[model samples]
Target chain A: MSKIGALIFGFNEYSLEIANNIGHKFGEIEIFSMSGAKEALEKEFAYPINRFDLSEDWGDLNERFDMEKSTAFCTLDDTAENIFLTISLRSSFKNLIIIAIAQNKESADKLSLAGANKVIPLVQTTSAMIADMLDKPVITEVLHNILYEKSSLKIAQIRVDKDDYFDGKYPTDIEWSREHGVIVLSVMHEDMSSEFIYSSKAKHHAIKNGDIFVVVGYERDIEEFEKLIGSRCDVSWSHWSR
Target chain B: MFKGWIVDIAYAINVSDSYIQTKRFFYNLLENDSYRFKKYFDMVMMALIFASVFIFIREVKYHVDDSLLFFNNIIISLIFLAEYLLRFWISSSITEVIIEQSEYDLMLSREFRLSKALRKIARQKLEYILSIRAIIDLLAILPFFHQFRLLRIFILFRVFKLFRYARSFQTFVSVLATKKFEFLTLSIFASIVIFVSSVLIYVMEANNPDSPVNTLYDAIYWSIVTISTVGYGDITPITYEGRMVAMIVIIAGIAVLAFTTSLAVSAFTEKLDEIKETKTVDDISKLKKFYIICGYEHISKEVAKQLVKNSNSLIVLDEDPKRVENAKSDGFVALNYDPGNIDSYKRLNIDLQRQVKAILCLRESDVENVYTTLTVRSIHKKIYILSLLMKEEHRNKLLYAGVNEIVYPKELVGMIAREFVGKPVAFEVIHALRSDYTNINIEEIIITPRMLRNAPLVADLHNARYRVILLGVYKKERKRFFFNPIDSTILEEGDYLVVIGNVLFIREFERSLYR
Candidate 1:
């Protein structure tokens, strides 16, 4: 139901990496750069590239991005240029969710004033995180370790019993209609193998006993979700938020 | 006085251009030290100094004529006086050049602080003359005070002028400076021992005729010779107490001598290392395809672990002297220069546009990382710029700055986590299929000229002798990825195929296809 998109504003290594990486999360991803320059860099990218004139009005872009269905990323490397892009995009569409990249705190403040919903600081994005993530039991296990550090979000692995109401339904369909705090990240099969929830293979897999669901939410939502699907481990870290 | 000087020098500067040229010429000789002719001026100054010292020594030894003495002392003094004043006149410009790019803010506020402008020139000249170098210059010409007979010995300070010419002595002097505390402690202890021992020995042996301890001078001289272990037989001890004192002095002297020697040796090694560290950039430029890793951090630790091996050359640029020293100790090429500045980048002379195949911007500050990436990108478009983005908001900005690869750990890990949950075995299979000197490997092989002759289609890969799966076809013209293209899909020259199979099998298939 989320019409999220990654709209990159430059044809660069940083932009291309983002497009390659964050592209899968978004249903719509559009890259804009200078015409011939975009075409020349086009050989290196798998994402679709569109020609954009920085000085022009965004009449065509406004028509393309539906407000309710779009989350646009304005990523020009220059601080002044990025602020101008945010201002231009925000002026064109008042309700659009515009996220931008900032080089420093000053630029972050300016981007926020220019109507960007979020500004990513460059310092915290070191390869050290990648080195940490590459260690074993990284995903769900590490999420628990981080939660102990006083994060508001909590992730718990729950076993889906055969007697549970979710047994006969598909994982994707169950998530679509369910109204709960829990967002299912992945599900582990009875065979002890995991699959991301809603993937082509995961969409058809039926819920069953001894099946594990890795869901993320606040403490209460996670607790309530735990009640519905029995958790193998003790539920704790609820007081971590304070 | 100004009007008289202009009229007196009219022959030398008949035109305005001539006046300007004369000023330019002196500015070069005195202040433009890096100029081709600055050294000749220094040589003349050095020769004048030696001549003055020689004349002074000659005057002391032989009674010279009154006029010749006047010429040697007064005329030479006059020449040095003019040289010293000329140097002082241009000294302010040297300070200005040293602080050139640093006065932008001061200039901006000049209108508000007009009162400070009144004495700025006079203040600069006064400050320069009071400095150590200026004082040294003044000392070299102080024979003008031949009026004060006591001050005439200060002319011997001309020997200090040699400190400027023989630069190697500067290193030795600095090494001595580093050992100053130890040397001071030794000197204090030795002085007290010598004084006390000489007084005691003189009292104990003054009545004995065999001892040369009659006067205080004889006793002092004997104590010094014994402490130095140079026991000149002309001053031997006769009394039992005197011999005991000599034994203690010789023991302390040997200990002090050993300590001094070791201290000097260690200091020399440290200075040698310091000298090598300063010239690291020169060493780096000789090696091609070396990576210039900017900044020192935990991330660089990981980078160093992997990159330090395999005959790969690396140079680190950091802003902290301590960090540079630490890197050197760990056997790394490092210099304390901020890579964000264009001047700093140019000094490296690494040919960033060509020879530097990759640059890693790993500074702790996101702003510095961004600025460094921008500078590097401007210098070289083809370089593979790898950077770590600390904030998600700056991703687009860094991407725009032309970073080839950005490691957003949280996002990338989150994505990987999401993928792992969906198809755990698939990623592992993909991982095992990585192509790098391995048997079972996956690689993206482009359509070679010979391979295009066969006009291979998507489904034709299964029929080949070697087992390789056609995972995807990378369309060159469209710049798109087609996962599992249909049998109807046609392949062309320059088209790349992402294949998964054994290394030897892939090679065999390639040979057969080309054949």
Candidate 2:
């Protein structure tokens, strides 16, 4: 039987849903609510659930959690209390993949401080949603479709390399949509908004050194774009590596 | 020869205390105290001799005993000639004056004398003072003609002496220097206005003889008075064409004045508002037992509702006064203040230590959260500071500032959304606590220092029939929490028992703890 992954002690409903959805993809799913963890455990015979209340004494929790056997323990609680619980449980279940939720940048730091393996922020997800919506559906849909197919749709932002073929050439002049098999959907201007989408009417829109191209392409195309345009991926993976 | 005589006189006038002391020493050694009197006598005798020469020259000019006048003039000239040569003989040589011990001492000690001692004083170069003395010397010895006596107007050159006393003139110079640009701009603008108005008025009023403005300068004068709004009415433009020009000038002048006034007023008003807001925030913060809401929004409204129900002491701080006023109108004790300012915290009596129990930082910006937490920590380190951070990156910064709790609205909302989608029952319980329709609410009770010493077990509270179930205990010392412990687990000091039921259960649980 595949090992069941359980997300416990989180205050958020969406986190539990996400964990359950992710868990259902692999094995049995269980959510041990922090508020009613004891009641849930007392009625364990009636329901297939595991309970762990963060409000309990740390000593009792440490002893009880040591006996549990699960693939991982994920927490969606955005409090220092939840993060401390996750860290304390990490020693007993060294192999348990610990995923935690952060309320904001501060809580994410606390989670990182508590030695969480993965800390996802709720704000960044929302910001990403806003960024996607503002950038338009067509480009987002294309990126989504590619990522959905289990292929990393690397949308890299590259500065126009002065040495490249399209260095000083305008977007219209290059005819990028037909040549590279990848669309240069938009360009991030210095003022922080997408530009080239609106520059289609202008006869000559010269590419500058600092102009970042938001190109949609496959892994190979991304690699080619990186090599040709001297661009890199925008996602900061420093936190994940740590 | 004249240049040498003038240099000697300057040397005498520019003498220092040290030089005088050395001169006294030489006089004492040479028994030359008589030389000082002798020098004065020689100058007087020289003046008398020059006077006689002047009288003789007048006699010769009138041809009255001209031969006798010539003889007298020659005798006086011979006497002055001897006197001038005698002065050179008595005066110190250039080399001796330059190499003198006292001169070298004075040069080393004084900045002014150092330049003089270096033979830097060139003759006739500083002729402003030299000319006055030389003229007096010349008047004493030279044969003066009556016809040339009218040339005394040359004495007016004495005004050049004012430049030597120029220190007092610095203030005037500085005023001119500073106002140079302003004066230039004003003059240029005035000239343009005058030129344009004059040309227009002249073209209009030139055909009409009845018009008072006869010349271009007169029209310019009228334009100045009219545009300045002075309306002296000394020169009126009677013609309709002239009046039309005047109307255009008046309108332009009014616009310029309005533009200038509005710019100044807006700038001053903005600064005044900022200062007033700062002071008001400081005044509000000074109140005891006041609650500080860091941000203004729906969450702030919820926080305010809970705070106002328990206590009337509450002050809401927001960058926007409209939002703060809106909160105030809603029966909240609100004050428009920026929590980032130290004065805002201090105004709410936050520094009183015991008065402020909690600080709620609910600003949308994580940067603001970090700043507020740091500021609050400076005044009261132990206060229950709850901050809302927009980003997870600021958690460590908030924690380092001694913040006890942090709330992320987006994360909480997302979690709530997920719960509503997946587990409807759990969601309902949370909804009741947060909903406006419900009276009952769930709040975390902090285990006080007093409660820990009593060592009350979970089962011992049965008399109260507190439906509250002991879910867990958080051990602060071990920095961990126990969840769903067995019934036999012993209750220890400093253990927080997480219980669930209702407000009544919470009250009973506390009551049982006392028992």
Each candidate structure's TM-score, on Cα atoms with residue i matched to residue i, is 0.37, 0.30
Across residues A131-178, which tens digit of lDDT does each residue of candidate 1 receive? 222221122122323233235555556776543577578776653213
lDDT of 2 by residue, A104-203 (tens): 5577787767766556655543333322322222323333343233334444456665535665666656545335645454565544444433243322
Q: Which regions in candidate 1 have their CA more than 4 angstroms from the true location?
A: A1-242, B1-79, B90-136, B142-156, B262-315, B318-333, B336-371, B374-395, B399-515
Q: Write the per-residue lDDT of candidate 2 for residues B1-515, one digit (tens) a residue.
A: 55345445656644667766755554442233223354455355545544554554465356656655554445554654554443333334443444453446656784234345444333323342245533444443443232454533322222222222232343344434445565566567766887899889988887788888788888888888887777887788888888888888787677556654554455446455555555554455446666567777655665566556554476777778898888878976566667778886555544546566567777677787788888777766577777776666677888887777666544544443333223222233333333335434333344565664554554453422454434345555675444434435556665555444456656877866665
Docking class of 1: incorrect
Candidate that scores best on lDDT: 1
By DockQ, the best candidate is 1
Instruction: Report fnat, model 2.
Output: 0.02
Error at A189, model 2, angstroms:
59
Instruction: Provide the lDDT at B345 for model 2.
Output: 58
Model 1 residue B116 distance off true place after TM-score fit, in angstroms: 14
Measured against the true two-chain complex, the DockQ scores of the candidates, in the order shown, are: 0.04, 0.02
The sequence of per-residue lDDT tens digits that candidate 1 reaches over residues B139-172 is: 8778678888877887786667756654457667
Q: Which stretches of candidate 2 lie above 4 Å from their native place?
A: A1-242, B1-290, B310-312, B347-352, B377-384, B392-404, B429-456, B463-466, B473-497, B502-515
